[model samples]
Target: MNSLSRQLKQQFSILGAFVVSFWTIEILDIAIFSSYLDRFGIIPHNLIGLRGILFAPFLHGGIGHLIANTIPFLVLGWFVMLQETSDFFLVTLITMIVGGLGVWVFGAPGSVHIGASILIFGYLGFLLFRGFFQKNLPSIMLSVIVFFLYGGLIWGILPGLGPFISWQGHLFGFIGGILAARWLSSK
Candidate 1:
């Protein structure tokens, strides 16, 4: 296989592992833990709730929630990786940290937030802003493509979308993505 094909295969493998792990966790949470693992999600303002930053993205409310996030996660994530595989990792880490901390600091009191929306929004943010930061033809084109496909999702960041919707996570995740794009493109 050509180098490009080989790279795509590797990227798919890694992304597939991510999906598998998410499914496995969900299955275990339902079969054995009975969703008890959800408590590990962001609890906002509490000390122990801090762990949710790392765990929230992997925990979903139900099969529907996981299914909702799965396609966007894979597609946007693949777009980020198209430029450089390592970028996928960097963007994810930044999004998790920024988005998680934002939720911890500003999320509703006594609320437990759990979902992959944060990462999904993060990927969106990175892709949307990456071209602006990079100022290259390829980056610009990728940004346009991402915008056309997912631009409607921008509304998700606003408050009052729904009682269960973690708009803060989406907003913060997007911010984190912009930061990642800026940070990575600078180097």
Candidate 2:
């Protein structure tokens, strides 16, 4: 196979493994743990809760929540990978740190925030800003496509969507993505 084909396979495989892990953990949490794992998610203003920054994205409330996150995670994540696979990891990391920290700092004291929405918003942020930062034709075109397809999601960053929605995560995740895009594109 050609180099591009090989890269695509590798990217898809990595994304597949992530999806598989999400499903496996969800199945185990529901079937074996009785949703106990969810407590590990982000809980603001508590020292122990800080660890949730690393774990929250992988935990979900239920199959319905996981199902809601799966498509956007794969699609937006793949778009980030299209430019460079390493950027995918970097963006995820930055989003988790910034988004997680945001929730930990500002989220409701007793509420638990979990799900890949953080990463999804991060990907959206990166894609939307990458074109402007990179200042290239390909990046511009990709950004436009991503905007047209997912721009409606931008509203998620605001409050009043619902109690369950972590707009803090969405907002910070998006900021992290833009930060990542600026940092990466500069280099």
Candidate 3:
């Protein structure tokens, strides 16, 4: 196969693996652990809670939470890696750190933040801003498409949108995604 085809294959495979891992972990958490794993999620401002930064995205409160996150995680993540598959991992890293930290610092004192919404918002921010940073037609077109498709999700960042929703995660995730896009485009 040609190099581009190989890259596409690799990209899809990576995306599939990530999505699968999310499902697999959720299944195990629900079926085996009875959601005990969710305790590992981000607990704002607690010293031990810092560890959630590495585990929260992978752990969901329930099947509903995991299902809710699955589609966007797959689609947006696929699009983010369209040009450079490596960006998926980098964006994930930055989103988790920034979003997790933001939630930990700003989220309700006793609340534990979980779910992949942070990465979803991060992908939204990345796609929206990548075009501006890259300054190219294809990127611009991609940005427009992403905006039209997922713009409604922007409301997720607003405070008091939902008692269960982590607006802090969404807000910080967007910031992290912008940071990733800026950092990547600059380099």
Candidate 4:
């Protein structure tokens, strides 16, 4: 394959791996582990819960949660990779670390936060603001498009919006995405 073909392949592979992992883990969490995998999620202020930073995005509370996260994950993730396929991987890692740590530090002390919404929100924020940080025309246009498509999701970051939603994770994930845009642009 040519260079462009190889890049597309890589991008698809990365996106596929993440989405498939989400499904696989959820299947195991439900059918095999009997939802016990949920315990692996982020538990605020708990020392042992720190491990959730690495695992939480992969373990969803239910199939519905994973399904809700998958489209945005693929769509926004694909956009992030538009600049460089490998950038998706870096962005995801940074988002997870920053968002996960925020949940650990500031999330409710007794609650466990699970699911890929953190990454979803992180991706949304990154797409919306990356243009400003990078200061380019195409990126800015892309940012506008993202906002038009997903602006309503911004409300999800607010507290007390609904039951079982981790707005803290959404807020921190957004913060992390902004940081990632700045950090990546500086590179």
TM-score of 4: 0.97
Tens digits of per-residue lDDT for model 1, 1-187: 6999999998999899988988899999999999999999998999999999999999999899999999999999999999899999999999999999999999999998888899999999999999999999999999999999999999999999999999999999999999999999999
Worst 10 residues of 1 by lDDT: 14-23
Tell me the TM-score of each prediction against the true structure.
Answer: 0.98, 0.98, 0.96, 0.97
Q: What value of lDDT does candidate 3 attain over all alpha carbons?
A: 0.92
Candidate 4, residue 88: lDDT: 78
Query: Which parts of model 4 are misplaced by more than 4 Å?
Result: none
Model 2, range 96-177, lDDT digits (tens) per residue? 9999999999999989989889999999999999999999999999999999999999999999999888999899999989
Better of 1 and 3 by TM-score: 1
Clashing pairs for predicted structure model 3, backbone only = none
Error of 2 at 81 (Å): 0.6
Residues 1-187, model 4: lDDT tens digits: 6998988888889899989989998998799889998998999999999999989989898888888999988899999999977677778888899999999999988899998889988988888989999999998999999999888999999999877899989999888888888888899
TM-score of 3: 0.96
* Candidate 3, residue 13: how far the Cα is off, in Å: 1.3
**Which candidate, 1 or 2, has the higher lDDT?**
1
Please give the range of 10 consecutive residues that has the lowest summed lDDT in model 4. 84-93
Q: Considering every candidate listed, which one attains the maximal lDDT?
A: 1
